[model samples]
Target: MPSNRKYPSLELDVSADHRPRIRLLLREGIIAVQLLVIASWLAVHLVLDERIATLGAWGPLLMMVALFTIQTRTNSDNVWRYSGLLFMLTVVLGFKLIFLEYPLLHRQFSLAMTVLAVVGASLLIRGPMDYLLVAVLSWVLVMPHIGHDDVSDYRWYLAIFFAFSISLGWINSRTYLRALSITLQIEQHYRTLSETDYLTSLYNRRALMDRFERFIESHGGGFFMMIDIDDFKRINDQLGHAAGDQVLRVLAARLRNMAGSHCAGRLGGEEFGVIIDTLSPAIALAIAERLLEAVRNSREAPARFTFSAGLVPFSHDQALADILIHADRCLYKAKRAGKDRVHFGVGEHLS
Candidate 1:
């Protein structure tokens, strides 16, 4: 049985792209650190003449900053990524001094690094806790590889290898995780954009209607009001689209705030719809009046336009279509009575 019985929301994010990028970065960093440490170890004896290893060891650190900048962190997790980078740095330095072709090491040094790499790969998927788990797992993986002539013969070198492996694994895993996190966020944002209205930051008509049906089913019955602004076209004509945009935004805010737990949405253009879970006609009227006031306050016109709402109650007996028809007629009566009131119809409401 899986520990995670509940699944996470399938929100695709930049983290997917990030996982690959982080992995690549860690790989490059570890490889570079490996080369530099090797060169530094050789230089100590008769290995190399130049002190180039000093520059190389720090080169990966610089790349880390650049990679992170491109990764664009959303929070504190961004700053912590470098901690893992430093761990990889340790691994490389340790590998060069103890496990390499020469030097003084305990026999277990090289064995430790191999374990570090494998466990680090696993921890890379786990995110931040890279240090402890990756380090311990590396040691467990290393013990089996020790040989008589190995660096284990120099017990001190073996300890260096252990510490070094842990550092390298931590650093490598950090970059990998940062990238994964980013990709995940990106995927999620994309999915939201598909179902959401970008302008008002609300659910679009599609989402609203879908949920409206669910609300009706859940509560056994309810009311559905199809609301439209009486003269929204005039606003667009007189104030320009931008100002019209502000009006729609203000109107949407008012509706959402007033609707509370009821489902509300911009059906499209300057129109909105609402679904409320209640059976009493009095409860319905109160909701309708509040909704009207919300729209009224949002407008600045002395001769401000108002919406005409058509409310249809769903009884256990009526089909959704019949309820919509009755509500539409009541809405027509409200509009015919001068366009700023809520009207209800158990049957068709005559103007």
Candidate 2:
């Protein structure tokens, strides 16, 4: 039989400090305001003083406090932290319903007891309308239960307060969530821009270097190919720089179309470097040939332009700089070995 392995716990993963601060502040705000309407709570609790000892009565109380504590402990989504207000309302209402302590805290704990059910329903419901309906129904059912201290009146005041409070809370949470989502999306876009070339929308030189460093550290296998467009300056000399820019853009697009998504852009006058994620020397050479063919075939000028490439797949004992130097040396050899060709660590011409 194989022996089971036990992993030892080492470090605790914690969220950023601001996350906890936000949870704590929101929970404090909700608890502060909700506890203020003490008139009805005191009225109900007076009727059943000894019921506090029962699990039914104390369970909801303990759960509500515990929920608030958990909400403030971690703000990050990965931490299973509660959305403070919703959790507080949930545990409070759920415990009340399960314990049927409605007669005790009337509206404070009992009036909005359906909100507890709404929070609970949120867990079960798949869409917005389902939870919204639960909330509406809970509010509706609690309508008859809400009234003034006097029976002579229809208890319209309590109804007005309940409706106003739920409406305000719902709208506030909706607006807050919308703003939060938009902010997150904008932040993500900004992060992408930081790592990519603005003109080409390709991974910039910095990002490419970072990836190369990681690959080297991991002993990753691949081919790093250097490509240079033949007679790029001659195009600019004959036509204007605008034409040169157009050709460069066109070249970038063609390269992208050839390589698909696994390509990066370094700031080059007429050169581009690609670290192809291929383990096969033959496959890397095939791609180099394909790129050479595609670029030469793309745009025809008065002197028909073509590209020269140098591919380095592996050097088991070579340093990183040595690999680049040799690849570059081979690139110049291809250029000298007559312009339009591909070289893989030798003078052997690519057909």
Candidate 3:
């Protein structure tokens, strides 16, 4: 049985389309860090200081409530991310304000330093530049408490702590960059697999339909052409499937070259299609004739093979399915009028 368990790396996947997941991870880490900081402070306070008169003892709990409220109430990822960053700053500034009134809490600057480092690492997504900004904030958080009597020992501890924090922040940022690269590569690979025909390297049928829908919504008129190889079954039956595949590939290349910036795709099997925008009926017919000629002249095939094409000039209001059906009918007429010809509509044929 295949394992249903997705690895932890799956959580780190960050692409342009997956930014919400990245924001969610950061928000969750923020919540966890806030809760842990609050709980630890309360536990230590209960054990050491029975007096409730300490500098803003109730402040962290209030912030916790606020963070929880923000998390629950807001659906915007940008709000969550920036609010979490602001919360960290508010928490640090709150401690700063309290320590001014109560010098006894000056020692807690070490704790504030740790908090800034942790939150910065957990929430910053912009890599080392972000880490540099957080390092500056770390200095600002710890500077006011530096001249206290016990700060000599605290200074030594802080020096080591700052180094650790910078290293950890760097690692976290690097991890984000690596994860982003991997996500983009994965996204590109999947997009290619979904949109491209495997054998012919042309846009697949599904991608073609999607582009056609976009064209319809744009309200711009264009020419739509349907192409079918003249005798693909005979080629496969007599020569081989390989020879048939070569013919398809060569034909697809010719169509791609002819279509230029326009749309071209494999509809399925030996049938292909193209849409040319902002072109007149005569130019569209000329392109159709050129495509037919390219297939006929292809030297990569085991034998010369020709294609029948149906061309239909459509207006913005024309239904896509109806236009396609009409073009297909024209293609059918070209095949019946004799193979290797282009048909604009009924009674309009060119060899």
Candidate 4:
């Protein structure tokens, strides 16, 4: 059947609108890494010289706590989450610069870890604007230190690493967006296959019932119809099963066209169901008559054939099973009286 399924629009930039679980995992991973860095720094200082480790370490630790708290409570789209990460990074770099006095190698190792954290955070933020903001801010934070005698000799290496980190983060983000788009397409394809009938290209029984239930819940009432081809077995026996299939397919197309926006589906064998969202019984009956006329005049069928239909007005207060049973009874009556006519349940008075 033709699908009315809506899909997400694919864009060039990566955002939190796709694959939320993956974004959550990446956020958690960044937080965990920051916590590891803080713990390791505290442990090393405690071993070498407990005096230097003092209350200064608390600044970075507290910043990490605030970052984690923001991540847990807010979504990626929140400005507070991005601001918190930048604030935490500033606190960490500032703390290292002012409070800690370590060797050149140790300082380089710490800066490299900070760069990694920035790259991870970049993945969680939206688009190029946020990414550029992060890249510039990180570079500015480390710029003053580039001239310092402690690590001035390795400035070129630091610059290269920064460039590489930015490139890597952008590439990863684009790759993630592409993968998410493909995943969504595959999911939509499979869902369409599951809901559609193979032969007649109409919604299957399960899909039709689900649509009927949803319509009842939303619109409060509609007309439910059960239609069956007259003497379908005779057509199959005389004209062969291939001709029977063609008749079914042609009739389904006519029904779908006549029903317009209403839900129409194959209910197995020669029986089909339609749900029309309308308050007027006359309008529903007119549509049913048109379908019967269309099937009767169709040249695609092996020979002239007619169908019987039963239509019932459904309300929110009525059970779906009861409505189907009532419609089926009306259909049975139509077949018994004579085929090629419309039968309607009680409450609909026609002249």
- Candidate lDDT (C-alpha), each: 0.59, 0.56, 0.69, 0.71
Quote model 1's TM-score.
Answer: 0.56
The better-scoring model by TM-score among 1 and 3 is 3
Give candidate 1's error at residue 229 in angstroms: 0.9
Candidate with more favorable, higher lDDT: 1 or 4: 4
Question: Could you say which candidate leads in TM-score?
Answer: 3
Which lDDT value does model 2 have at 90? 49
TM-score of each: 0.56, 0.64, 0.66, 0.66
Sort by lDDT, top down from the best? 4, 3, 1, 2
* Greater-lDDT candidate between 3 and 4: 4
Off by over 4 Å in 4: 1-114, 126-159, 258-260, 297-304, 346-351
Most accurate candidate by lDDT: 4
lDDT of 1 by residue, 1-351 (tens): 001112234333334435455545455554454455444445543443343345543454454444434323323344435545444444444444334443344354456456545444444333546456545654653353455464456667556666676666666656555555655555545655655666665668787767766666667677778777787788888877887777776766766676433767777887777777787777887888887886776654433567998887776554666666676777778889899888776555434
lDDT of residue 300 for candidate 2: 36
Candidate 2 regions with alpha-carbon error over 4 angstroms: 1-54, 57-92, 107-109, 112-144, 148-163, 215-219, 259-261, 300-304, 314-323, 346-351
lDDT computed for candidate 3: 0.69
Candidate 4 lDDT, 1-351, residue by residue in tens:
456544444544334444454455556655665566567656755664744555555655666566656665566555445754564465447545542455453444556655665576455554556666666576566542333466555778767777887788777756765675566566656777788888887899999899888888888787988999999999999999999998898888887787544878999999999987788888887888888788888888778889998989888877788888888988988999888998888574322
